[model samples]
Target chain A: MSEKHLQTGDELPAFGGKLRLFAMRFCPYAERSILVLNAKKIPYDHVFINLDQKPEWIFTFSPKGTVPALEYEQGKGIFDSNIINYYLDEKYPEVPLQPTDPLRKAQDKMLVEQLTGAQSAYYTAAFSSPSLTPSMVETYHKGLEVLQKELEVRKTKFLHGDEPGLVDYTIWPFLERFQALPLLGKQEFAIDKSKYDVLTKYIEEMKNVPAVKSYCLAPETHAKYIESRAKGNPDYNMLDTSAVCCMRPRKKKE
Target chain B: MSEKHLQTGDELPAFGGKLRLFAMRFCPYAERSILVLNAKKIPYDHVFINLDQKPEWIFTFSPKGTVPALEYEQGKGIFDSNIINYYLDEKYPEVPLQPTDPLRKAQDKMLVEQLTGAQSAYYTAAFSSPSLTPSMVETYHKGLEVLQKELEVRKTKFLHGDEPGLVDYTIWPFLERFQALPLLGKQEFAIDKSKYDVLTKYIEEMKNVPAVKSYCLAPETHAKYIESRAKGNPDYNMLDTSAVCCMRPRKKKE
Candidate 1:
């Protein structure tokens, strides 16, 4: 068996020392978890996972074989980025990530689901395609349009109204990545910044935040990562649009 | 618009001032929220939603357009059964549905995701088909095999461990429905109880629980529901699977 295919057993790393976040730096889901940790000022270890060849330990703990798994002390491993954020909120009740209002909390979670489920597909289709197909572009635009409308309705400084909360932390990473992808000769899908004034302003505001800004990759670097994948480099563990994009745009017959 | 499609916007009848849970009796996701209410013994008005004609409020609040949704006193609606359950657990912390141990909590959430993402697909394909196809039956059995193996390894009374927790509540309702559909002759997917002794015992134990048993359709009634759907009744929302059986099996096709 390839060394890359080895499995990581379900054991938590020693804790009260440092919590390990197994993540891919460019993955929005992973980024969301990091944003929560940073926002809460929690100190921990960050293990940047190679998505192409996921460590066996990761698969052992997360049977779904996904990244952004958390290893807390006492040999407990938590999978799913959103659940991990919730864990942090519960474990560290101070500076809660979710809202106190039950209804608002529900909305926050629904919006996160939308980002992951609906909008993701559009971004994925655009990024994975060898050349930007018209269908892929349209899908990306539709996703952005939906996001733009939702942001308009919220009319908040961030996704969850006023201060950045779980919703904002969860979505911004993807939105930023979507915008960054255009530098790789992927045509900039018109976002109509004026249509989503709140989102545009929120993006600017998020960039100013020390933690978000610190982790934010320069556009050129991100494009380089995409370029490497397009070149079919075997060692490419970089962000492949296929991994991140959830929406699969219908392919047209050649 | 049909009267059934319109929302009165009026408050639904409440039990102890808690809003009603309008859901299909057999939906596992719906059961998750209901389990929370049952575990807490929280009084709630139970309004069974007809899957054939979903209420407009349900579609408006639930973006995915599935159940179970909750209507609060202030016209605030919560959608997505899992998110709604989280709202309930957080707002009514007196009887917590989630485990306090971070590791156990993570495992609980992961198990719930697996049930929804992996296992549920089999039930969806099998039960949703107009006629049970061999391929659908194969898919259903494959899902059951994975579930059986997982149960064997854990050997817990509930999905998480000894006591029933969130994952058990989330999955049990769906499994109940999946098992019942075959008895109706709508499908003929086999699940050998002997192969999964723990799961067999678990299902029996679940059946005896007053809350679970009370909500479950009498075997005769559930059989009727399945038969009605098979007859192409417009009122039946379950998928017809008759065409599936005519198709070749997966291994042969490959």
Candidate 2:
């Protein structure tokens, strides 16, 4: 894992002999693909970049310079969270995350699209935009209600039946971030446990899924990152571990 | 083909033995799927509904009362143009519009996403939106330039190949609708013959594709629809031919 924020003038990182993902520490979109990668147990290298001042090479991987771009080969890549995740699931089909039925697969994608309403509302709330309307808050609740209904109808431990699948991973990142809304002073955005009982339980279960558990962050951490980004100076290195040493100081011929 | 606008309290159209698609007369999104069905020579029926006054049963087919919902079974469906197209391409593999190569498939979807900039701009211009900005025009051109660049690099008669594929059909509708912009007084939206020689040629070829040729309307017709829609009264059933006789009023067939 490399947590370096390579800027416009920085050199491209040396290619590692594994699938590589260009990501930012705090992007929910990036986490969607990450969860899929972990769920499939695919061996890969994670390259974290600063979104605000992205390196030129990032565009080579992602045309829009967006995160969650996968460099499957030294110079070959693909971007877009859903596209990348679908590619990953198909290419590494040893553990398929998508449902086998075509209708089920379409429904999974629809669920992801439906959840984006709340995600958009979260974005507005996090960015502290003054234009965040009441309807936006309503949209947030409607999104949650849709998920709860789906949970009840599917009658599964996770949206993906016994375990989390593509649908679960695709929407989990947004749900994971939605928890930080109350901390951001957007109380209306918080999930009311009493109302969303099924969804609430599902969230708890997702946090325990090995794939998500391995990489998910707490609401406080997300809130802090949101605060910094809202102030126009995103703290992209909030989770950097590259600075840590091997517990031994450098010594000559030690 | 039924170009009738069934409103609330209207009966759901009886299931036709074959697959059915709920569409609107002038919707580009709906046309996307229609073209796919035609290109594949799939047996299906089309139900043209009035979007503004959607039938109560429309939700049974499409959750959001949106057009282009595919009624694959008696009471089951999958919404979203892309989702419907993917389902059709998968279920009816007799003619595969999608590339077998995963990377190429991803790129095809990405190109659709990329062209959305121009589509949004066209929407704004067609609606005569006050919010239309110079940046919107810039975005429209940027989208065109991107397509031009891709066409030049791919060196293919069509985006898919000599034969039009999913990418071509997916994008052709928007390109078809875009021609209506110049007629709507948005001259900036015009595809200058000299500036976009390649794209212009591609557009002409797509219009001639048998699948597209059968259903696509003239630019003047599209411009008229845009004008009516801009006036807040969309002439949805402008081309209604449901009342027309099979030929000479059945010529006293009885």
Candidate 3:
């Protein structure tokens, strides 16, 4: 009977019905949602929202009022990208995005959190300024260093060890953005692929995955989108690696 | 094949066997794991760890080396608190911790992430410092204001609409800590609980939940633990909230 409950009315379709993702192409969190969907191969509709002007429906569904919200008609809408990923994996149960081993799954989730929660903010801060500040650059480098050290020890093809898993999918898009930031002449925190061989190989392997390779928007497209944003023409529609990772439809070509 | 993987060895126990949680008592993230087990009525063994000097065995299992890790008999170890909670709900389907609806689940997860990832940090920074700098105070206030506004709009008995859900369990422990911090004379930020009647009432309601009430350590005991840490005792035995929340059999009954 409260306004929150009323607002959170059954907005998503019924369970097993079509899944719709309300996402921003550039949002790493949105990309995390996209990656899980892709891993599961769940076919869903994608609505790309403009960051400058989020769709009204998003505010209606998301109490936190952030993008990467999912609608699965089980009589309600799902708001978090990570939770949406879990729901899809649980409901679909075809190609599990998470490892079967409980502990490994937890490790994957933790790694993803580190990237999304901690490192992502540092990257955002470093990139948000018109010109990167020295401290921001230092923070960004520190984040990368932590990740680099972690990756060194694990040495898996992806973040979750071995084949591309949830953690890799969750983090790759954000790193992809960081990799491209140098295009904007902000290269101070650019990850030197040569220096971190394991990470370089991991990125390359991710690029080669069928779902990732086919569905991911080209780097050129993302560059163009960034350029468009900088030019004051804000409706940039190119999907980031995260969005591409999640939105890959499971059903094959007819 | 590596030493890390081989330590647990191949003969991992089945999923239904003993569940061991390595966690810190006061950590909100660890509280999430406890919440799931409490909700599901699952029995487990709790291992409290000193987070400051993490044991070698824990580091071997938890690659990221964070608390709220789980060691399941099935030769699995999970690191993130959220992932462990999800795994428990999935593995034990009898008492469902997640909502049936996907969207509601998403909302629950998002709120949890907001609490764990963002708001909790704000509260920690707010409560730990003697006097917050102007900028630090602003950030803390901003976070609280957002949470307060959201709570005002929601007006639910718990974080989820009708009943206590994942978010409530995951977040309440931190909120409890925040409330208790003022008593410690560590109040750097002000919280006007009066403005958000629902949140205030919800906290009161949470205190009465048998599962929550019975498992939570008494405020005085918890304060003692915090005091020891403040006094520069490095070898402190921190209670893992997971153990408390899960209502695991303790050596000494309260």
Using TM-score as the measure, which candidate wins?
Answer: 2
Q: Rank by DockQ, descending?
A: 2, 1, 3
TM-score of each: 0.74, 0.92, 0.62
Between the candidate structures 2 and 3, which one is better when assessed by TM-score?
A: 2
CA deviation > 4 Å runs, candidate 2: A241-254, B241-254
Better of 1 and 3 by DockQ: 1
Q: Highest DockQ among the candidates is held by which one?
A: 2
Deviation of model 1 at B196, angstroms: 1.5
- Which one wins by DockQ: 1 or 2? 2
lDDT of each: 0.64, 0.88, 0.62
For all the predictions, what are the DockQ values? 0.47, 0.71, 0.33
lDDT of 3 by residue, A30-62 (tens): 887877887778887766666565445567556
TM-score of chain B of each: 0.73, 0.95, 0.74
Model 2, chain B: what is the TM-score? 0.95
Across residues B151-237, which tens digit of lDDT does each residue of candidate 3 receive? 677776666656666667777776666655555664554456775555567778888876688667665555565566556563243
Distance from true position, residue B125, model 3, in Å?
6.6
